[model samples]
Target: MVPAIESVGIGRLATCLREAGLLLLLALSVTVAAWLIRPEKMSLRAETAFYELELDAPLIAVADALVLYDTGSHLFLDTRTAGPGSFVTIPGALPVRVTTFDDDLYENRDFLYPEDPVVLFGDGNLPAVSDVAALLLERGFEEIMIMGGDLEAWRRTGGPLADHQAGEHE
Candidate 1:
């Protein structure tokens, strides 16, 4: 009789478990259906527009950069990390911190001309230069040039350094 009662309890437990599982499955299916039919969806056109933005910036030798620098019309953007180490940037160049790129760009938007040449340089940070160049291109900057040399090269090429050093690198 005890065994018979135990089997009956086990059957009830199995039925509860099966029903619970079915309920959970139903809930999950409803959640997924709602997500699939959500009103707001990501726009593929925006992604395509972003892909269409030209990310390849032309390279400009240090010598050519020097010439453009002398013209005083071209905008020189220093995208090097600010702080420490013997990093010297071109005098009068706009300092754009790689970490705060968007804010720096917005702050200096008045100085930016979409049609003017924008020279970008960094202290052996090629990615930073390329990223900044891409952002400039996205902002409608026509001529974005990544300086082919490092800050030391710029310093050697008679490119005057700013009066204050950025800081020291650790």
Candidate 2:
């Protein structure tokens, strides 16, 4: 009876080990197959223009931005996402969502003329603004500048803010 029980236990252990080995082998085979079938080359520009934009767009200090705003010589594009509550934006800044940049550009084509000097600003890090700047460059916007600081910086510098409530006439 001891010998019979030993034999059963050994058989179950062997079966479990064999199944585990097969599963591991299957996973390895699938991984190798996927690796081999993956594309060998991709266009970096086509895939991510923003990466290039980071290298190209010039950074503008808050003081310079204030000067530009006062002169009204350049268009101010705010790339921040609208948050809950009344929208507070920089005076004369056009709200631009990076996700809908192309549509927004088309809708505001008159203001976003290709030749105009455009200044982009958003949260301090400038991720959304950078992306929008890249898209603008791709669309033939020649002069794009990224504001050095964010909304807080603008506030700190005494930049004017306007309440942009929906349904209210500007």
Candidate 3:
């Protein structure tokens, strides 16, 4: 009887171990597939990849932008000053209004940190984003990125848009 009981316990233990091993392998396989099929490589320009997110554009170093804003050191601007202009924005995204963009960035140089990430956004495939990136580079902004997709993608993703047009305080 003792031997029979011992054999049953061993069988159960072996079954549990097999199940655990299978689960681990399955998880590992899924992780590897996710890594391999990840979307287009991160681009530094506004021209590459299908426009998807404004609040979290892959083309933009969104992580850096968060760092800058969290520390009160950086500015996110809608670069769609030409054509029809931007229609939405990432939630809580502060405007680099024409007045400030002109005076603050150009004349006053407010919040100037060469290392800070300056993110510029605009409409799909617009040139303004790249222009801002270049200008910031010239201004010694060590990190600059253009959100590949403009405000449309932002709005579609339920990203917060400023209430400027609605007369609500941003």
Q: Give Cα-based local distance difference scores for all models.
A: 0.73, 0.76, 0.54
Which sequence of candidate numbers ranks them by TM-score, best first?
A: 2, 1, 3
How much is the lDDT of residue 11 in candidate 1?
80
lDDT of 1 by residue, 20-64 (tens): 999999999998787788543333355443344443687777877
Reference-based lDDT, residue 9, model 2: 83
Predictions: Cα RMSD each: 19.5, 18.3, 9.8
Backbone clash numbers for all candidates listed = 5, 0, 2
How much is 162 displaced in model 2, in angstroms? 0.8
**Positional deviation of residue 8's Cα in model 1 after best superposition, in angstroms:** 99
Candidate scoring better on TM-score of 1 and 3: 1
Q: What TM-score should be assigned to candidate 1? A: 0.58
> What is the Cα root-mean-square deviation between model 3 and the actual structure?
9.8
lDDT of 2 by residue, 71-127 (tens): 989988888877656788887677666877776676676666889998999887666
What TM value does model 3 have?
0.47
Clashing pairs in 2: none
